[model samples]
Target chain A: MLSEKHLPAFYALGALLLIILPWILTAADSSYLISTATRLVIFAIGAVSLDLLIGYTGLVSFGHAAFFGVGAYVVGILAFHNFEETTFLGFDGTLTGLIVLPLAILISALFALIIGALALRTKGVYFIMITLSFGQMLFFLFVSLEAYGGDDGMMMFEGRNILPAIDLNDRITFYYFCLAIFTAFFLFCHRLVRSKFGRVLAAIRQNEDRMTSIGIRPYSAKLLIFVIAGAGAGLAGALMANHTEFVSPGLTHWTKSGDLMIVVILGGIGTLIGPVMGAFVFLLLEEFLPIIFHELGMDLLKEHWRVVFGPILILIVLFAKTGLYGLIFKKEG
Target chain B: MTQLFFEQLLNGLQLGMFLFLVSAGLTLVFGFMNIINLAHGSLFMIGAYAVAVLTNLTGSFFLGLLLSFPVVAAFALVIELLIIRPLYHRDHLDQVLATFGLILFFNEGVSIVFGRTPLFLNVPEALSGAVQITDTFSYPLYRIAIITVGLMVAAILWFIIVKTRTGMRIRAGTTNPEMIRALGVNIQALNTTIFVVGALFAGLAGGLSGPLTSVEVGMGENLLILSFVCIVIGGIGSIRGALLGALTVGLVDTLGRAFLPDLLGQFLDPATANGIGAALSSMSVYLLMIIVLIFKPTGLFPVARAA
Candidate 1:
């Protein structure tokens, strides 16, 4: 029913341009474009993982940022100790930035495993609140940990570990590394969705009761996907800390979770690439809207731009059934 | 020390009442509408603003209190008609996002209109002095008045809900919206009324609280989360549950902050005890919530059905 030959050549052109735009934009804007793009890519990765639950699995987690924050805190706490110091484990203390990422994933996944196991038992509004309650639990934990800069947050004075062969701190190189990670994740997520596992996830999304009728335990599937999503988000958080060289409660705030959800909805659910585009738009709006408003001497509007942002959401949900991606590509003729 | 303890208990009760005022409407909205309204706090903020402005305009506390109900309820009606009504048909994510967006909008709007500086209101002279509770403890008469007023309001609300016709429709609609519709109730009007009731409750809390705390921009944001935790721990929709949850959270929170340092000081060095105490104090409420969730996933007073 579908053929690569029939897909528009312009689609390929668009993808190429997306990749190239960052390179050119970074050249013109220096590190801003690269860092911004990297941030968008990181958030996009998290969003795709969320898509596995929210889009494919039909599970909505208002507390997804708990994982994101967990990943970030792990990176922060590790670096707080390991920035220049040796570890208690007796291993070489100075591993590269890439080495810390998997650790962050495991730590975040472990936390998610515990929280999700309990949270998944409840359905509907209970599910939302339980997840939120767990998120708040973590938030207060971080807030109370005056040991790690507490509410104000700590700055990473050190950047990513310099690979023995190549400098990891170079803006362009770091940008590419992040870009490669994003591309790999996108492809991985694409393949994941096509796998038979994706089909079960979809079935569970449609009806867990029926899935259980067929002998597939929905709880394990939901928990597994939740942890996977958490791991994915955790990776994004690790990259986020490395890219910005700072980690704060801002990463874990419920509002950030809401922002991530907004991105997924804006990009269109069930589509792997939608969140990437959505993240791009959201970050672009954050970057540019204030500048435009300030330059126009409407600085008052700067603080209150959500007045405009809110209406955009109302309009988007009302008029655009899918999202910007859906609007642009009309479900393949 | 005994006096302070007594005072703090009263303070905790006062805070619990404020939480109740906010939580009652929030719980009703959540329980009946199945809508997680993050913007409920915005209504609280709006109520505070209303009180602040009215107090400034008329220089009368009663006038401000009197006016906030209608103003806040009217605002709720408009919001319900425009934004929230449509969301009833959608899923929780949609409701969450739209309400969250409303939070941003309302917070920024208030900040712009009212400025970031905290607004202060003075309690009327009639309620200002301390009442001699004990020889060592002289609690603020104003706070005592707040407690009396809060208790009265809670009682009236209980009475109205348990012994009123409108409350029946709300209870019915919450349990079964389709059945209520099938019974030919005007669900739209009923929903708007319940939303208004919720708004008025929040507004009343705000009006009552303006003198006690700083009425500044973004005041409602954090309180919103805390109150949500209350309802979640209380079980989503039960009035009695909300009250119990609020009192429990208020006491645990206050007691932790008050006594945790002293408790830890006995075991550890003073500095470490202070740090650990503060951390534990902040965490104790959430710990209680998680413990409750662990044992009773449906919350203490399972409203709809046990999970």
Candidate 2:
């Protein structure tokens, strides 16, 4: 008899089968659709970072975008003098923008350290609101830096500083780069879940107090994961800036944060690949609604795509409460 | 400096009053229900929309307010019954997500219903002028009226909670729901009333803010977050805490924004001062919140006895 504890890998195989549907999406002449899909994957990376904290680690953070925004803004500020500013780090201010990923990751990890150090002192809703406040502080900081575009975010004139002489700005190259990053992040996340550290995180999630009673200080582990998650989000943000060639304060808005949370919850949080799947569906819907509304000639709905999204969110919460993955595949205890 | 100080004081008070009105209902519902209502802000948004549209249609702001509160409260009651009540025993995580979804739906619904352009809620001619507060600076008469009305609401709310039989049960319900239920009190009825009251307060606040702000989509979100901060500071379930939190937040935010830049300019370069000042100004209230949490995690007046 099937038990409540375990799900088969066939579900994941099915997921992999669908993720490549984007090849068909490239039918349009321009890489607009592909890039959009790429952008969604980037956000999925960030969402997955959050899911690690929120879904599996049992911590709800409303400020993951702080890491993402910081990552984007770092690139924007560094590349200020150069429109397609590549390598100042290694190649005399002429490196490809992709080469700057380490810098973004490091900075975001540092931020998570300060944030997590203070924030870990609180728990429950306090944790959520405190993280949110930190994000707001960073948001205001970015908004105040007029030189870096202030409320109006700076547009990237060039692609990332790629290493090894790869064509960094090429759309296809960046698309594949994003795909590789997601794959690596997915695999990395999968391994982490099955590792000892992952088990500690899961144990903490199931019950932190009990974990504490057993002599495992959940705080250190949680903070460690927080840094890792921040690094993941920062990498995603870097890729996003590279992919879109634009970065804005909208990157740190609370609503954007909410969307990430929704994606995490929607994708079946604990499932390794769920966040990416959630992001794909989310962005697809985000794209599809406007086109459908336009085709249907509901001129009013052309701009109200979010209205459609909101009810869909409600329905997901109400009916498909386990999220798409959970609805399809039950988790093992 | 005195004049500047006085100006900041008034600004803080005005901001505090607005927050107090909104947070009153939020804290109560959160306290009694243990449910985090992210959609409460949507209810606030809807209330503002209703008040704005009705005021425009009827050409009577007071009438609009009169009609708006009941309708908003009713909507809240219906939501509680249809959507919220059943989820009471469900996981808190589920409630948070659902309410979050509600916020999205409502924001989009408003966008669809009302054109994206910001709606202007015209101040009534009756309250358009200003009352002189000092030499060189006279405050708007309508804002003064708003403060006065807010104060009156606060007084009545205090009386209702402190004096009435219903208030007694509500207070009991907050402290020990099991006890209240065991004593034959219908918590369903109480929860509904609390929800209605919360809606009414939010609606009134929305109606109040309509004239001061551009009434439009997502208007309630900022206010909602601020009010949550207020409730947190005030002690989530304590009405007294909400009031104090509102005042504290109001003062810090308004005063910080009004003068922090100039204060910094005295010591730093004009541009650097402005940039850093703006950041600090926006962060003052949140800074205050962090300090509060550090000292008093449960807040100034936590209602629930145990965790």
Q: Write the per-residue lDDT of candidate 1 for residues B107-184, one digit (tens) a residue.
A: 778878888899999987678888887676688888888788778878987887788987787777767788888999
**Model number 1 iRMSD:** 1.6
lDDT per residue as tens, model 2, A1-333: 223344445545644644653666665454478777678778888988998898879889888898998888767666665654444445434334554778889989999998888788778877887888888878888888787788898876655655676676776676667777887887798789789999999999889999999999999999999999988888888777777667788898877778888898788777756777798788888888888999999977877787777767767777776687776665665
Poorest lDDT segment (10 consecutive residues) of candidate 1 chain A: A1-10
Each model's total of backbone clashes? 0, 17
In candidate 1, position A65 carries an lDDT of 85
Across all candidates, the chain A TM-score values are 0.91, 0.90
Runs with alpha carbons beyond 4 Å of true place in candidate 1: A1-15, A26-31, A83-95, A295-297, B305-307
Per-residue CA lDDT of model 2 for B1-307, tens digit only, reads 7877876787788889888988998888877887778888888888899999899888999999888977897789878987788677766666777888788778878877787898898788899988888777778888888878778878988898899998888788888888889999989988988888888888888888899998988888888889888988888878888889998999999989988889999999998888888989998888888878778877788776544
Residue B146's lDDT within candidate 2 is 80
The candidate 2 chain B region of ten consecutive residues with least summed lDDT is: B298-307
Candidate 2 Cα outliers beyond 4 Å, as residue runs: A1-23, A26-31, A83-99, B134-137
